[model samples]
Structure formats: structure tokens, C-alpha cells
Target: MSGKPKLYYFYGRGSMESIRWLLAAAGVEFEEEILETREQYEELLRDGALMFQQVPMVEIDGMKLSQTKAILQYIAAKYNLYGKDLKERALIDMYVGGTTDLMEIIMSYPFIQPEQKEGHLNTILLKAKNRYFPVYEKILRDHGEKYLVGNRFTWADVQLLEAILMVEEKCADILTNFPLLKVFQTRISDIPRIKAFLQPGSQRKPVPDEKYVQTVRTVLQMY
Candidate 1:
């Protein structure tokens, strides 16, 4: 009800995760609004004031902005959550873009039959992870465990953790074989800020059940 910025998110959905994590990391307060049904979304859409072409839009002083990555960059810039230097911001963009690629792959599965998901895993997920994941591992390895950039927490780190956890929860075996990614993920999850965000009550909406998690995992791990 307050006039502060508001974020509209779906429970357990990808659109909201990174932004939610970033918001928590910045200690930037927000109003979390849930859209639990298509009807609700439709109603909002019908109103014609919602920003871009998706959920997880942020309303700042009643102005709406949409698209997950755009929202993220906006908030990061506004709150000084990105980093101090040009190189660090570039790295943040790289990792965040990588996450977007991963999400695209996962979203593609919705159109495939349950059985076909495995095929995607074998062809797409396998190739992508093998090629791209090591890049991320190397980043973490080079950063020396202080943070994604300059020994300071940035939106990039929050984005990485959320994307990694989404994979861990939905596709457990996807990156389990990567030592650095696994270790980095564990380390990120252990951060006090991130740990508190992962707590049950902090959730703005109910998480997907274990069965869905396993189902996603089973299909994604086919590679």
C-alpha cells in the first residue's frame, strides 16, 4: 500500500528470483505482490498500465518497468548494487547474460513433451554447460572467494546464486559434476544475506513441490 517500489512476482518462478535476491542483497525494501493465477495476470494486463511484456515488473513511484534483466540492471544502477568499476559491471553483465541463456533453455522445455526434455538435455544443456559453465567457474576461481567483483557484493553475485539455486532445485545433476560451480554455489548460499533469503518465511509465495523439482531434474540431467 505504500508508495515505494513494488515487484510483482510469481511464486517459485524464474522471473522473480534474481531480482528478489538482488533486492535482498541490497537491503532495498519492496512490496512483494503475488500473481497466482492467469486471471489475475489477465486483469492486470487488461488495465493497460503494466510495463513491458512479462511478470516480475517493478513499479517505482507508480511507474512500471518490465523484463527481468532490465529490471535487474535498473535496480543495480539505482542502488549502487552493481560494482565500483567498469570491468566489474562488464563481468556482471556477462554472468547475468549467461543466466538469461540458461533460463531460455529451461523455458523451451515447457513446449516439449516430458520425454522430449531429455533430448534437449542431451543436445542443448550438455553442450551449453560444458562450454559456458567453465567460464563461470573460472570467474569465481579468479575472484578468490571475496565476491564476484572487487571484494564487494554486487547484483551479479545475487544473480549467480539465484540461477544456480534454480538449477540445483530443479535440475540437481545439471552442474553437480562441476566442482567449482558446486563449491561456489554452496559458498553463496551460505552467505548470511542469501541464507536468510532462502528461509521459508521470507518467501513471497509458495515454492514448487519436490515432485516438480525432481521431474525437472530428471529431464535436465539426461545429458
Candidate 2:
């Protein structure tokens, strides 16, 4: 709590990206320990820093946290971004849960086989248009609020903004049908903290390229 939270993950965005987004949205500046080699990760294992031997471990508030959901929930709660009540928190959880499912697909794209990359991209765009985007679009249409939950900028909004950008990276016009989401994306991106994070020289990671993929695979010892 005294010092800035320290994150342990690869140089590129993966499960750790959402954590970065949440912290940024909360206006919390943190440090990162990038794992560029297998030995660095194994050292964490050796020192018992990783709870489940995962890379997205965060050392914060005198605890070493792993598991993406747990870490996200803690940060959201601590930063007062979860919700004011249980019902609102439930909605945030639901919205974030759905968004996480969509992000997971994108996160795995780098490791996918070259032959299947086209099909994988098709799947991503398909789900974004048919399944995922519609859900948030409907929520915004019905809620008539600036954010998904409680009309306040919470973890759900941060996650959605991150997802929207990730999807748009694949297809620039993915939000053409979802006008509300396009507005939401622009509005959220303009928020002071998020706006700062969006600018150059922030902790935001770039889209995973071949070098990033190779580095991750090498560090994880994954063929």
C-alpha cells in the first residue's frame, strides 16, 4: 500500500493488461517486473512469489496475488471502483466476466498456429459482432448511462474500453454497427486518467508482434 504495486508479467499484454487498465483507471502508478527469460519466472516459483505459478502475479499491499479474477476484484474494491452495493457489484462482475471471455480469445492469438490464424481472427470478429458487442450495446441502450454499471466509471468500463481497442486493432470498423459503443470508446478514452494512459510513454503495451510472441514462448518454455 505504501509503495507502488509491482506487477510481474511478460513485456506484452496478456492477462496482465486488464490489471494495468484497472490501475490506470484508478490513477494509481505502479511498477512492472517484466519476465523476459524462463529463469526469471522460475525464480518467482523458487521464491514462492507465485501462488499458482502464474506470470500475472502482483505484489501489492503486503500480499503477492495471482489468479487474474482475484487480483482484479481486489484492485476494483480497493480503489472504490467495484460498486456502492452488492447488486451493482454483481452487475460489474457479470459485465467484466463477459468481457474477459472476449479478451481471452484475443490474448491467445499470438500463440496460435499460423495456419489457423485466419480462422482464429474470423472467430474473434464473429464473436465481437454477433455475441459480445450486442450485449454491451443493449446494456448501454437500455441503461442510458455513461458506463455499464451505476453510471460511474468502474472496472467494467475500463475492461470494455480495453476490449474495444483490442477488437478494433483487428478490424478498424468493428464498431460501425454499435454507435453507442463508438461514443463510449471516445468518451472513455478522453477521461483524464485513462487519457493519460492512452498517450505515448504510458504503461500501455502494444499489440503483440512476432517478437513479442517469440519472447513469451521462450520465457514460458512453451513450444
Candidate 3:
């Protein structure tokens, strides 16, 4: 609140990635306390910083917050990105909820076994094309609006753009059939704040590589 919000997570993108995107879109500069070892995670628990004993905890507005959705909602509201009215907020919530479903699958991708990677990738593409992408595409088509709700750029748009990039990382042609979403993605990415976040040397994290996966496993003792 007073100073920049500090994020607690691994160096890799996981649940914290959306928080990063939201903060960036809000034009908020934040700090990070990356966890590299199991001890660092335990210390947060020992210090009672993590209410649910989890990473992705954010120190913001004089409170230590955990739970991905709660933190995101707070940031969205604080930055006036939620929406103008309750109905618009509800629409944004529904759209964001759908995007989160797809993002959650991609979030777990790094931990997947080598042999299962292809199957998982297929699932991601399938869901993106058949289920997720179609919904947003239809929203834009029906509303003929630049954004998903109230024709205003809100948290839904931010989450949608993040989800689009996550899916594109799997297959570049993932949105070929979803023409409106293609335009939507371009429009959202071109926003000044969002564009800065997409540029090189920004806080945007790349797809998780072997080292990132191993580091996360080691920190969480997932082996």
C-alpha cells in the first residue's frame, strides 16, 4: 500500500504470474522475494507470513495476503480494474473464472512427466480451441466491444490476454479460428502498461524450463 507490493514465490511463473500481470497492467511497480530453497519457504510459515502455508503470498496494503483469487481480487479492486458496477464486475468475474480454468492447467504443466507432456499439451490445445477460446470469441462477437465487459479494459481483459499468451506458447496457431480474440489480444497487448510488461527485461517470466521445474520441486520438497 505505502510502498511497492512485495511478491513471495519462485523465480518461475506459476500462480504468481497472473499477479505480476495484474500489477503491471495497473501500472504498479512491485518487488519480489524469490524462494530458492525449502528453508526459505519454511521460514515464511514459521514467521506466520503465509496464512495458508503457501507461496504466492503478497505483502500489500499493510497486509500479507495468500490465496491466488483473493490477492487478484484485491489488486483488481484497489487499482479500479474490477469494473464500474456490480453487474459488470460479475461479468468480469465470470470471464476471469473461465480463463483461470485454462491457466490452472498450464500452471501445472512443468510438473508433468516427460511421457505425459504430449497428452497434456493436446489437452491444453483442445480446451483452448473447443471450450475456452470460443467463449471469449463469442463474447467479443456478440458485444462488438473492445473488451469482454462493459467495453472497458478491466481485470477480465488482463487475465484473458495472459491466458491467450499461455496458450500460444503451446501452439502459435491456437487462435487462428478465433478471429475476434486475435484482435482482442493485439489490442490488449498494445496498451501502454501491458506493452511495457510484454517487452524484454520486464517482469514477465518465460515458460518453465528444466531448471525452473527442478528448483520448484526442490523448494516445495515435491520429490
Candidate 4:
């Protein structure tokens, strides 16, 4: 809260969206530095804060932080959103890892060549439901809780919600076969601050690109 928290990322919703989500969830105030061109991003590399030469970097409390997940956990720990106990924190990490795996696929769609982008998007949609969503669905079923870990909201829920939103963007009806996930997604969407961040006119892309996504109304049909 001392120095203005600064975030660096390209415009639109990319890897940095989740970082924004965590900040909003924590009710923290931060400044944004949108990297608009390759030159700008390259220039940022000169600072050495971005060790990986990637974005979604942030600076807070006089420390330059890179790596999306690490920054997210840092904010979570700062806001007491990490979790209540040791085991819950571990489970939170597990779900966040799974969510990241699925998000990586959805995020790759735009960079793909036009001819291959459709197939890439379809694969992402399939993998999101087939390979990842079920784990959380089962966790929700077994735990009978509104949030992903423990009985309260945690950084894991924010991560999972972002993943689901990312996949839903690619496949609008992808969750039809997974009602539990749909509910889980809704629960997070209604969070007051998150709701405001997601309102109409927001910069978030509804999909990676309209041309690449296919309308998969039923998840079972992914096979």
C-alpha cells in the first residue's frame, strides 16, 4: 500500500487477467502499464525484472515481481486469500496447477496460424473438459462446498474460475455436461469485485478470436 502497485502486461485479457483478478479480489489498488508493442515489451526486458522475458509482471513494495503464478500467490498471501491451513494451501496449489494447464491451451489459440487455429482451439476445448474440469467437479462433489478448497474462497477459486472463464470463452456451451462446474463458475462470477471487473465494456475478450472458436454445445460430444 506504500508505493503504487504497478502491473505490466499487454492490452486485452492475456496472462495478466488473473493477476488483475487477484488484485481486485484482494481489494488492492494498483496501477497498470499496458505493453502495446513488441518494442515496448523488449524494452521492459532491459530492467531484468522479467527473468523469463514474459509479461504479467508486477512491481509492488519496491520489489519487481515476475512469473504469473508466483505473483498471484504473493498477492494471495498478502490478502490472506492463500488458505486457512497447510493442507488447504497444498490443495489450492493443486487446483491452481490444473487450472493453469487448461488455461495454457486456451491461451495458445490466437498465436496459431489461421489454417491450424480451429483444430488447435478444438483440442483446447476438448482437453479443458476431458483432462481438467472433471477433477474440480469431483472435488466440488466430494467436498460439497461452494469454493474449490476448504469452505471459503481462496486463490485457488480465483485461479479455477479464470480457467473456466477462459475455456468458456472458446466454447460458449462447453460446460453443459458439467453442471457442477457451471455452478462453480457462477459462484465466482457473482463475487462483488469480480462482477464489476467483468461487466460489459470491460477489456476482456469473450473468446480468443471469434473465427477460431467452434460452438460445442455439449461436452460429451467432444469425443
Top model number, lDDT: 2
lDDT of 1 by residue, 53-167 (tens): 4576788755788877788888898889778878889978987888777766655554566788678756555644676677777877876675677777777777777666655
Q: How accurate is candidate 4 locally (lDDT)?
A: 0.77
lDDT assessment of candidate 2: 0.94
Residue-level error in angstroms, candidate 4, position 150: 1.3
Q: By TM-score, how accurate is candidate 1?
A: 0.78
Question: lDDT tens digits, residues 86-122, model 2?
Answer: 9999999999999999999999998899999999999
Ten consecutive residues with minimal summed lDDT in candidate 3?
A: 1-10
Off by over 4 Å in 1: 37-39, 108-111, 123-128, 143-145, 170-177, 204-223
Clash totals in order = 0, 0, 1, 0
Candidate 3 Cα errors over 4 Å, as ranges: none
Q: What is the lDDT of candidate 3?
A: 0.93
Q: Can you give the TM-score per candidate against the true fold?
A: 0.78, 0.98, 0.98, 0.85
Assess each prediction's global lDDT (C-alpha) against the native. Answer: 0.69, 0.94, 0.93, 0.77
Candidate 2, which segments miss by more than 4 Å at Cα? none
Record all residue pairs in model 2 with backbone atoms less than 3 Å apart, i.e. clashing: none
Q: Can you write out model 3's per-residue Cα lDDT over 1-223, one digit (the tens) per residue?
A: 4499999999989999999999999999999998999999999989999998888999998999999999999999999999999998899889999999999999888889989999999999999999999999998999898999887889999999999999998899998899999999999999999999999999999889998999898988888
Error of 2 at 47 (Å): 0.5
Q: What lDDT tens digits, residue by residue, belong to model 4 across residues 88-194?
A: 88988888888887777767666667899888987998787788987888999997989887789899988888887777767789898889999988889999877
TM-score of model 2 (CA atoms): 0.98
Angstrom error at residue 192, model 4: 0.7
